[model samples]
Target: MVMRVVVIRVKILETNQQVELDVKSTTVRELLLRLGLTLSEHIVFKNGEVITEDDIVEDNSEVVVFTVKSGG
Candidate 1:
């Protein structure tokens, strides 16, 4: 028997780029680290809902990353 790994699609709104991660599952923090993004610098959204770094993101799911910006 063989197991199949589904890819997770991550779309970065700031960079306008999309990347695929091959894994069974991953945490938002891990995903950010893999993409070289900082938790404080970026915000993650899964299925249009904001997710925390501790949140678990499964494979084959679409995620969006937005750069955090502030002006004062």
Candidate 2:
């Protein structure tokens, strides 16, 4: 029997925090939720490309998140 592990690197632009996670499969939304973040309040980028919350994050991938801000 063999087991597979997926590791993802995450970075939060606002907080300048970096984390590495070991997961089998996960979506951007799930990752955000795990990190105590809100979907509508942040944007996700996978390997320098923008990705939606529903998008599945790949193994050994880099995920970057930026907080959304609105000002008048």
Candidate 3:
């Protein structure tokens, strides 16, 4: 059996905290959930474009997740 490797880049907040995760999921939501990330108000961008939770990612794709902050 051959396994495909998917490289996903994750960026949290406004900082430069970047991390790479290897997964074999077809959708972004599946990858996030697998990485133990709970989707809330955080915005996710794939290759600079905003993507939904159901967005499917290809192999060696870069995914950036930013947490949006709101204040009173």
Candidate 4:
């Protein structure tokens, strides 16, 4: 048996760049790790909805990763 990879569109707020990639059906945490980004340094949103590390990511989902900022 073979498995189909899930595809998602990712957007980076810092660079204002977008990319479509094939990913495994997994949690947001794994996805961020695969993207080479630290979950603590970026805020992730799925299809306009804020998502947590444990959130499940599906195919054709839109994800936006924004760099967390510090304000004083």
Candidate 5:
């Protein structure tokens, strides 16, 4: 079977630029690695809800990846 992929452009706060990524995996973790990103303690949200690396991303899903920071 041929799987469909969706490429979504996400804006990263640190870079202030849009990164177009093609997701064609069964899990979000695969997509991140394919985009050359690592899943650390930082949080990742899909439409505002926190999602884990094991989360399955459906077609046309909009994902936002952000690194968590702590400061006083």
Candidate 6:
């Protein structure tokens, strides 16, 4: 099977960092892993909407990862 590559624009709210990544069109869980994400204290937004692990990361799409603090 052939894998599809797409450009992913990621914006990390806490660090004010913006990065562009070229990744496969797979599940969000895999994509996040590709980005070296290991924690679950953040939320992901795709196209200004909430996304889950089972969601597909579309080609040429933008994603935002917002870090949140809990149990204050």
Best by TM-score: 1
Candidate 3 deviant stretches above 4 angstroms = 1-6
Ranking of candidates on lDDT, top first:
1, 2, 4, 6, 3, 5
Q: Runs in model 5 with CA error above 4 Å?
A: 1-9, 69-72
Question: Can you write out model 2's per-residue Cα lDDT over 1-72, one digit (the tens) per residue?
Answer: 766555898999988999888886699989999999999999999868899999998788889999997743
Please estimate how well model 4 matches the true structure, expressed as its whole-model Cα lDDT.
0.83
Off by over 4 Å in 2: 1-6
Clashing pairs in 6: none
Between candidates 3 and 6, name the one with more favorable TM-score.
Answer: 6
Model-by-model lDDT, in order? 0.92, 0.89, 0.72, 0.83, 0.66, 0.77
- TM-score: the better of candidates 2 and 4: 2
Candidate 1 residue lDDT tens string, 41-62: 8989998999999999997999
lDDT of 5 by residue, 1-72 (tens): 965456654545544556666654447677667666677734567888988999887656676777666553
User: Model 4 misses residue 53 by how many Å?
Assistant: 0.7
User: Best lDDT goes to which candidate?
Assistant: 1
For model 4, name the residue pairs that clash. none
Rank candidates, TM-score, best first.
1, 2, 4, 6, 3, 5
The lDDT, on a scale of 0 to 1, for candidate 6 is 0.77
Q: List TM-score per model, in order.
A: 0.88, 0.84, 0.67, 0.79, 0.64, 0.74
Roughly what TM-score does model 1 have, to 2 decimal places? 0.88
Q: Using alpha carbons, what is the TM-score of model 3? A: 0.67
